[model samples]
Target: MSCCGPTRRTLLGAMAVATLSSALGAGASRAQRNSLIATDLELVTVTDRSVIMTWTTVAPDASGQPVPVASSGAVRVAPVGSAPVTMYESAEPTPFHYAEITGLEPGRRYIFEAESEGVRAVSALNPVTLAPDAPEVCGEFTTLVPPPGRLLRTFALGNDVHYGETVSGLIVGDFPPGFRSLPDLPPYPEVMLAALLDDLRAPDRGAQRLILAGDLTAEATPSQSRSVRAQLDSWGALGRDYLVARGNHDRPHTGADYASCAPATADHRDCFTEFFVPREELVQHEIGGLRLLGLDTSELDGTGGRIDRPQFDHLTGILTADPDRPTLIFGHHPVTRTSGATALAGPGFILNASDSTELQTLYTRAPGVFLHHAGHTHRNLRTRPDTPCDVEFLEVASVKEYPGGYTLLRIHEGGYMVSFYKTRTPAARQWSALTRNEYFGLIPAYTLGHLTDRNHVVHRDFSGLT
Candidate 1:
């Protein structure tokens, strides 16, 4: 047998070449396999106890389904000095993905990954820290202490981003014939958010979080959802945590078949649940002895603009649970009226008279709820202080349309300060002018003018219990 055609050495050499070719071919095949394109990957917000993450897919899959990706992308979350990476996974069919990572240690640096199809594409490494503690990315933030005094840095609030929609028809009953499409508007929600974050990161000031009251999109469309998420991710890059709420637009509409409005493969609520609800609601973060309580006010259909009984009960429970903590409540709708009219009037109008009364009654009785932050109305207006409870209502401006801006809330030992910061970018300024021009005739004669107007006041006070 050894005396065969080729010598042993020749045969061995041929076998080695074949093995090499096989290995090379396998490697090429692996490389050719389709990848999970990652999009909208972002750290939305980070509180003292939780971190919010959200992202979307670049394209739909072969089944025409929006691909679902979790916190498994190129980003990984790790405690400041810890090595163990927290593993996050998504269920499936994700066009827009959102995850809330909880049980985080306060003021500790946490690293996260944003991977696409098993490949690490981007990394939000050591990107965020739990709230109540200052961030280490730019530098250390002094923990806010209680009364007698501590410097409370100012932060902004924005809601109803409503990307991808033409605002022309959204106002009143019909779209003006010559009106330009909202998509053409400059500094769309995404751009406005970027600018807002930049203003927050400006030198010499420590702006902590950007609270998004809700209605992140015009409707829960995949593209719209992705657009909003992308804007949020951009803000996260600046070390800002976006506290979000669910809005009427954030939910599925009942028109025709409910399925038509929702992601084809996932449940109707999946879109909203994936991108909005954080890991934990009822989050309590201390800003110098004052606690901030972010509540979920956007309820399912048939309950829009109104807090359901369960949520009402939950508010009472949380207040009773922590009676002593000076707390701020954040939601999509205002709890009181600006005038005789309601703050949220059904779906089309601002608050209705009855809706305001019901919500006010519930809020007045709740303890620890001193400051209520809202942003469904695009206008900027501060409500008269409520008696007994002494709660102050702040309706933040919208990011996508006219007078596009946000409200800055500063909490200190004596009390707090609230101011509206108008996005001064060219695009924002242009939109502000256009909206004023187009809606001038129709503008509510009673409410405050554009948020950018000089008369737009930054109502300040320490008399309220904080």
Candidate 2:
């Protein structure tokens, strides 16, 4: 359990549809009556204007025999004392039921009901909670309102989940002796991830959307990418509530010297793209009159980071279009060299100087580009350009290792503040404490934010955004 609020994981397990007490229909055959149990029921892809609910119903006879039965599923939405809207209905036997409802009005309250196997069930929890019901589900939910007061918007940033390696975390210089070779107890990435999500979902957290900076998988292999995406789908819908960027650890190549490999292309690859987000890897979106830009810095070699020309040009277009527009640019690698890495060569800490210089010039011109959030360094970093950078560069620690949490961005009309919150679930706190054993306990001193890294407030005259 989390100290912050009741977690989604608690609700997910609590609401399994098969075990709920509900009325049994009398019109069915004996086997039909015996086998109408629905399990693994939940909702995902829940946006302000839409939601997708999914579940699996196993119609097993009392004798534990698999019986073929025709099934249909649909979602209903309505206000009090009104005829409910049938948002979606389908008979596709994709081994489960997935129904979606769209075209909803934000900030309004509505009730949702899921019907499976011709039986309807309703849940007391809100649809945002996505709690299941007996052979179905119903809940009330209020769509998220636009960010309040001077705050134009809010987003949660997390990275370095490294979902599939199940082994050593990101210690990527000379391979440490007996590190990857040593056996891991088990994959604890999920525990850390669950904690992070719970913290993000907490009512006091106040993020309207989530953006993972990068390093989403461990090995950058196909299986790692697929596993990460699958887990994310269960956590919530990717495109609807959250988005991800690519990292060196998430590139399409591998080495099993720890046994690994990933087939690649000229400057781009499809492994991360095919599964994570179907849209272009480098893209920008405008929200609350501010632009949010995510960059893919995963290089061909997979160790260092670099931005290709195509993405740079695309970014140049955005920055030049209106250098005055308040924008947030995020990527996996830091352009400025990282502190606390005294043992490593200077080159290892950041992208090459030429790449850094090009961006520095752009940032100097784009006065409204106030912040840059990055990952992959797996350490908390706050850096500013030497040329009187108005832009505050913020780099967050990894999600799967060390301090193990994420940063929250609160953008207001006057200015913005960036705060780091450690994922505070019992499971996360336990794993975070245990995982400090990583890198010979040196990980905590640096990866956990020190002073300026965790909480930094910047004041600017951005009242013009209104």
Candidate 3:
């Protein structure tokens, strides 16, 4: 239970659809052609006075097949009893659109209609409503109340960069086809990462620091690790401005391409460790009096994660020494199962059950550890463990594929807010839209979590953090 205000999960879960899966599979098809249709429209980010909406435009192709097509985008927003306002007139046509509606009054409800090439977008009838039901209105959402107290810090959290991979959505065993970038275009990973950096540079999204939770590379090859490192260095001074955690794909590999590197656990070569964690130890850093703990949860040979004895002991000592210090933990694998992850891959997709249980027990002793950020499973989910502690386990979506983006953590004196942002660069948006069909079109249902999961406010007293 939350020690602050009302339980956020309970309140939000009450408005959730009974079964999102059934709605996605059984809902009536509202297909159309001969005109532009905006699909997958979502309120990606909702702040106190603004919301970022994203969608893909569909139009008839050369073969008369309805497909994602480039088109100008705009939105009509109007508060009740007020005239509609048009915003976000794109100068260039793009198949993928990100529309930011700003200048909204806090706590005011507004009706919105997203349009492209004169065709208005309609929300898919789903069991769960992203906002309060406005039956006759096209779409409606209430802006949030700003967190109380002075704003102190902002950080960008992203992961699953997957630097060297040419293909995405490839799983072992017989699965649906994977996707690759257009032959003449740059790799999808590079396109998305560049766009992420560009977006982070915006004044409104000014991120003082960055934390890439895991999966820094497609494979832990020396070349791949070096290339990824160079790219990150282009953004900021590595150890001071950004930190990285290891994911399953970053674990040492035994492939012949890495035969020259030093051996790691078992027969694999340790290129990722050599480049990222030269000291081969867990890292802890302090910024503005806030402690950041980076954990390497990758195992030697499997997708499941486990902390080494030494690293676990070090974490225990650190937490025991400063039980009340404001802290945020970042790692590759989630410590608990998220609904989206379970619906997609089952228990193996997260940290091993035993390790997760032990960590939860540890969290019980640390009152100031409020959030644990993780990647892997390529989804957006926020879950609270059944343990007595009040910490939240947040899983961010991938930066290298569909729904490509990161989450912004805004720390205020009295509380904090988290909002997920999809990469907005034109190329990045295109790649994201193309990969939405991953896993046989089941990705959206399992990866694009409920609105509450992606954007929400958590009240906590952190005035002492500096």
Candidate 4:
């Protein structure tokens, strides 16, 4: 699971996941039964002193009856050898709980177990640094380690989580038999993402921030959008440790036909922005000395994308604020050449020609901008703008389907390195392979690329950035 794997697009084919998480009162029979099936367990947020987790409680038998809560519910955590476990219980009886723990020691590891009434389950966040002799049944996670030196911070980048998009074909909005929906697969986003969270919780990958470049959901419906946003929260809250950019699919789509049905947006606007990038159409922030600029370069009801004048200007101001600060700007549309199914790419797969040229020019002028990452092509490709600048335009593969994984960006004092790490959990790997042939079997050729796409080196003179 640690090794990099070939790329491919996963068509959910067919999977049925309950659309709702929390239900109302429980049936009398369920009152005493521990029918709470907790899945999608995740550490939603973790800081030097606190951590938050969220998960779903599969509802009771579908007899149109309400599900009962456990007689008692609490998250139990303890050090490996510690006998007494610390339990944090929620007063609410909902299936969805954001279990929170605070005042934890940074870099300390703990074994966590969650239980409510009749069910007790262990955490899946196994530690990456446990001793071989350590017990294997317990769920373990360590608080994030603080960056040591001139290293301003570390962040993780992932994209294309099409929640509710069981059939990969619908995501591309197609009707070919190959793009037809299959009803025999497991939940696409849930299983793959569960495995991803499992991997992120490990000791070595405690990224301080997470940015989803775009395509946050299959269709922007309320439930799907809500669920996708919640899934992202399984890592951290929006505006804090996690943020999102809009994708062409994330625009305010509306149609009568299911295939054409687009996920609903906020104020009839784009929910992708509402849920994650609520503060601004484009986001700009600084971590230590490292700057991150997130832009929404997508269009409504369109398969392609664009960097609107407003967003372009917003980014311009951000880049101008600290031209010398090491910065990484990202969005949904690619800005360079792509491979595979080239005929199907159309204009939107990459930025429009005019904008592309202008962006390269802007990047060249801002030498501090070392990386401009994107998604949407669902393939991994790295381009060095071909201008008088070092800005590398990289397009990351989709995270929801085959080759399910993400890029880890480690920012050091002088420069930074990006390495693609595939999700290691059995479920993630299984599902990724299961959906590998999406888009008429051309996804593999387009989404996965040469080994160079998975690893990159950026040597910049950062002697001044301590």
On lDDT, the candidate that comes out on top is 3
Q: Model 3 lDDT vs. the true structure?
A: 0.77
Kindly list the per-residue Cα lDDT of model 2 for residues 1-466, writing each as its tens digit: 0012234532432343222211111113224444454333444333345554554443444543433234677778875456677878874643245565777875676777666656552321233232232112335544444333387667888888888755554355544311221123346677778777777777767687788888787765667777778777776777557877777766654344323332355434446666764222575666667778888887766467687787888888889989988888888877774432421434565666677778878889888888888887787778766456687778888887656778878776766666676665544543553454455434544465443456555776667665
Question: For residues 404-427, what per-residue lDDT tens digits would candidate 3 score against the true structure?
Answer: 999999999988889999998877
Residue pairs with backbone overlap in model 2: 123-138, 255-260, 256-259, 256-260
RMSD of each: 21.1, 14.7, 7.3, 12.2
Global CA lDDT computed for model 1 = 0.49
**Candidate 3 lDDT trough over 10 residues, lowest sum:** 13-22
TM, every model:
0.56, 0.62, 0.88, 0.62
Off by over 4 Å in 1: 1-149, 176-187, 237-240, 254-270, 278-288, 299-304, 339-367, 385-387, 440-466
Off by over 4 Å in 2: 1-149, 169-186, 254-269, 277-281, 338-345, 464-466
Identify the candidate with maximal TM-score. 3
Model 1: per-residue Cα lDDT over 1-466, one tens digit each: 0111332322332222222212211222222225344432334334444554443333223443322323233335665455646465655433334455566665565555545556432211111221222131221211122233444555567776776555432454564421343344443556656656667766522577777777777776656776777767766732226666667677654443344333423344335555556322444455445556665665455334655556556666777776655677777766554432543344434444455565566556665556777777666666764345667777766776544566666665465545454565544533443343334323222223322221122222333333
